[model samples]
Target: MSAPAAPASRADWPEIRTGIAADVHAFAVDDPGPLRLADLDWAGAPRLSGHSDGDAALHAICDALLSAAGLGDMGEHFGVDRPEHAGRRSADFLAATLRMVRDAGWSVMHVAVQVVTRRPRIAPRRREAEARLTELVGAPVSFAATTTDGLGALGEGDGLLAQAVATLVRPGDPARPA
Candidate 1:
């Protein structure tokens, strides 16, 4: 029998002339005992624990952006084991992720983040959070807050959770090397 034709590689496929990519990510962090600092800055609020500042919202956004760009998740890019990332601010992570995405030939279109927690009500800081994220990503960012209705770890006031979606666009032809 004659040899079968091999499937075409991505390089041989038709180029994407123009379009946008989107992705979503969810993350949660528990209290790191009584000593660690939390990412959210609200008095009397329990902190989310992690090697970094543990801002669930920013972590989710970074993961979403990386996913939208076909890049690895946050853990791979910035693992807890990496001493350099220790105690790093969430804003710094967001900035670094944005730079990586741009280097990969994509631009941010928008970002939306939703936080779930029983403590540290986000409503009061919604505008400030959105403004800060927007400034970091250099694009419009939306913030939403919700509670788990006294049902989960968050409801129990043990931690915070966040979910985010990011839209990215490739301005030029995709076939061209980034």
Candidate 2:
């Protein structure tokens, strides 16, 4: 006659957290060549202006991951003031962010990002972008894009905007029963 163990309380369950973040970058009026987004290059597309490669999607994902892991935002670690990060690739930011998260005992479970823009539509490259992001974070990443109904600067083709949500879990924690 053995009794089953009591169900674990929510507080005792494995830690799972979600973080949201958004980033925007204006089109680079000066530089002309290709645009970098989600770690992929869009040839003949206008580039976004930023201290880095100006990949808004990747930047938002980094911020979201950091937020979920209770780490500081991207600017704190890779701000414009950081001379070394100037013109750095967005994928580099992602790698560094992942390291910070792992160091904090958290692993990214998933990330979803949405891009808002009027040009260089994302549909054609969604798969490529997701694959690149998943490879970089070692987690599943989803991407989508939309327009602002032609109402604002983004919709008018002035810049790119990206928003992301990330889910994180503490490794080695007991999984919750379904």
Scored by TM-score, the top model is 2
Per-residue CA lDDT of model 1 for 51-85, tens digit only, reads 77777777888888888888888889898889999
Q: Deviation in angstroms for 141 in model 2? A: 0.4
TM-score per model over all chains: 0.75, 0.90
Task: Report lDDT (CA) for all predictions.
Answer: 0.70, 0.89
Q: Which regions of candidate 2 are displaced past 4 Å? A: 1-7, 171-178
In TM-score terms, candidate 2 sits at 0.90
Could you give candidate 2's per-residue lDDT for residues 14-76 as a string of tens digits?
678999999999999678858888888887568989998999999999999999988989989
lDDT of 2: 0.89
